[model samples]
Target: MTPFFASAASFVDPLDEVSAQMHDVTSKPLRDIVVAGERLVAVGDNGLIIYSDDHGQTWLQAAVPVSTDLNAVFFSDPLKGWAVGHGAAILHSTDGGKSWVRQLDGRTLEALFVDYFEHRSGLDTERAQSYLSALLSMTRPGPGQFFMGVWFDKAGTNGYAVGPFGLILGTQDGGKTWQPGNTSIDNDDLLHLTGVRQIEGALYITGERGRVWHLDQSSKRFVMGEVGYDGTLFGITGRDSTLLAYGLRGHVFRSIDAGRSWASVSNDFAAGITAGTAVDGSGLVLVSQAAQVAISRDEGTTFELLDVPRPTLYTGVVSMTGGQLAMVGLNGVTTLQIQ
Candidate 1:
């Protein structure tokens, strides 16, 4: 005979959650969403690049020049952009995301160290000397993290990429050259960085475990910010002067005072939230792992579920411009719009 267990979980409708039950998308991981030149581009796992031309009416797969999983992409214009990912996979595109050119790859660093080690071994010094030489040569740098997010500072030149192991890489010459930024965090498994927004002349990075960090240009240091939730923070968006963050266990934190401190907001769902976006300039929408889409009109105080076509396990949500959305995962890509 099979064993049975009882639970206290309740079903909330997506539509009736606000009044009453509940419900909840992408191609790859579809980690980041951005709008450029009337086009909406979403980048994700396995070098997946997709875009919508006519205000997200439909989406088509865009060709990527690299093979590595593109964790992040940013376009200042429809004509020019850059995408970065693991294993030194940094690509540049002049024709949007249709095609890309390999710029800087991390594999080159490995090859560089290989050559350095082979040459140094001929010296035949003491064991201490050999060990020290190998250590120095292996210190590969420049976007060293498993890059998760990329952003431009309201210009085509200055840019930043943050990812695993608290790595921060900045470029001034349009990513032709990159330099390291001050990352003091000691954690090594900092997986995803969702958004790097400019608030009050400072850049803030939001990511896993409610990890938020701020960059001070004047002092040239990265100061960690307070993210009250211990759960993973996968997305962050700025509306007006408020910075909203969402993550595991329906985690929602808002900072009305420019990300200095955060306050927890009540939410209906108890499962992890995957993505959140501002809808119609008045309401916020969230896609959670419970295979449901929840909408909150009053700044996440409550939620309403939507009837979606598939479960969250089957798709990932990528929010687009004009409140349109796209989901990609197991069965390719699907588009969603509020009629």
Candidate 2:
């Protein structure tokens, strides 16, 4: 039996060692950040998983159950949570990220290929060869190939995942069983998906290219919703009565009337706003890809850079209990005690 808790040093690495440790660019920036009670979890390339019990002040690496790159994590409770990434890998932690078990190996794609070859669906040799080659290529290796965005439903029993090649998977029975869904969007990468919040009795998923899809609450069928812009929509966050969707190169869209209409806020950042998070009734914190952290208290109007000793890429920020701020990102995780 292995242990759940490990030292922070195991996950923390220097700039150069990061690439080799993760078998790729370690400094690619930790993308997904979520808080489960006092526990903070962040996932990134090559199965990197880190958790902090005392806010984001100190982080310890968890025994990753898989070697695939994980992109996003969502927790409905402190103990029950799910993480998703490349190769369709999905991990669940019943003990609040202290320990994680690979629920979905993300290798199912590979197994599907093996079965396809073994059964030999009776196709021409050339066509079969082409199919096999494409499958292999899809599973080859790298970021963006396998899985991307992962979200848990409000009930947390089910969640959706998306990635390259229009991949979409849904899980029921609390990550025990996942069902594949048809993402009518063709030839485009669905970077991220946001779950629905009750606003006028509708739920919507906002993804790449400002693509917004609505799920019928009663039927649970995804119907194409209105799309505002065509760009690499990166992150989506909802607060109060409005929804905020952002994308690459600073494209920000805001909607107060659900997904019906939107207004452009700003697509500009102070050079490296790789990821951001909006705190309810507070402000937004944008973390630069270059390890710079900035805070905008004026409702995404302006930003003030924070001073930190060890230059670290601030991936995302969230408000914690006792008015503290938690920041997570590449190679470094730190928390500011709100004075």
Candidate 3:
């Protein structure tokens, strides 16, 4: 038997490849979907971004500068948006997801961490050393880093993205530059931050081991909040003061006082919930990894599971025109007309 060895020359960064080539990806796996004004944009593996102006009726692939597997996409406004994915990649699009340009990647992220930690070492040697060690472990090369969630403030001025090993980044000047936000949060164990959402003018983040953090404007830091469940939370969703955090094994908790307290929402499905979205008027929906959809009409007080047409592992969900719902997951994009 002959053994083969891996070499640096054989490795290629996904960001170096262009994603302009297109095929029929309607049946392909898509991770997330968002509505940008009247158009709907969906992103998934291999840096694929497809937009549909006529509601999921037709799709056109966007010009993506990278071929990495994008995990999340967010549009602060109709024309400005960002996408984050594997390799700690961040891509920006100015024209409503028609095209994308790389803003940050694992290499840039590594440099940023090194520079930030080196500067921080002077102020707090012990803390900086610990953080520097963690950062160094992730920067060992390849596509080991992943950004799971991305969100922008309503005004489109401030933006944030989160990922594994407590990686968080903030950008005040849109996507022009990014800064480390790990110091702002109290993540002692370096848990993976899987999801982030802005609720009631405040930002909240969910992560592994039942960790939930709320951004305190006065202190300019993310303060940890109490939650009963200890499973990994994949996504957070709600409107106004009501919020829902869902994750492994279909576990969900509802927060009425902006995450100060959480109460369990009754769920029957056993599949892990991957994403959720709030309806326009007064409702919310959560999607599971097994393609199960749960609808809560009473602001997450209760839920009713709906049978999907196909059983594909879903990753994200979004409300669309006329009370419709569009889900993205293992099978590209699917539309749901809720009655």
lDDT of 2 by residue, 255-294 (tens): 7766677777753354434456665445666666666665
User: Total clashing residue pairs per candidate?
Assistant: 21, 6, 0
- The lDDT of each candidate is 0.61, 0.60, 0.85
lDDT of 3 by residue, 1-339 (tens): 433445556666677988757678777789999999999999999989999998888899999999999999999889999999998899999999999999888877777777777784354878887877875675342257889999998677788999988888888888788877878889867788998887667788999988789989899899998579878988788887788988999899988888899998888767999999988874899999877998988889888988777668999888987888889889788888887
Worst 10 residues of 3 by lDDT: 1-10
- In the range 71-91, model 1's lDDT, one tens digit per residue, is 567787777787777654667
Candidate 1 segments exceeding 4 Å error? 1-31, 109-145, 183-195, 199-202, 314-322, 329-331
How would the candidate models be sorted by lDDT, starting from the highest?
A: 3, 1, 2
TM-score of model 2 vs. true structure: 0.71
> Of the candidates numbered 2 and 3, which has the greater lDDT value?
3
Winner by TM-score: 3
Listed in order, each prediction's TM-score against the native is 0.72, 0.71, 0.93
Global Cα lDDT for candidate 1 = 0.61
Best by lDDT: 3
Instruction: Give the C-alpha miss distance for residue 282 in model 3, angstroms.
Output: 5.0
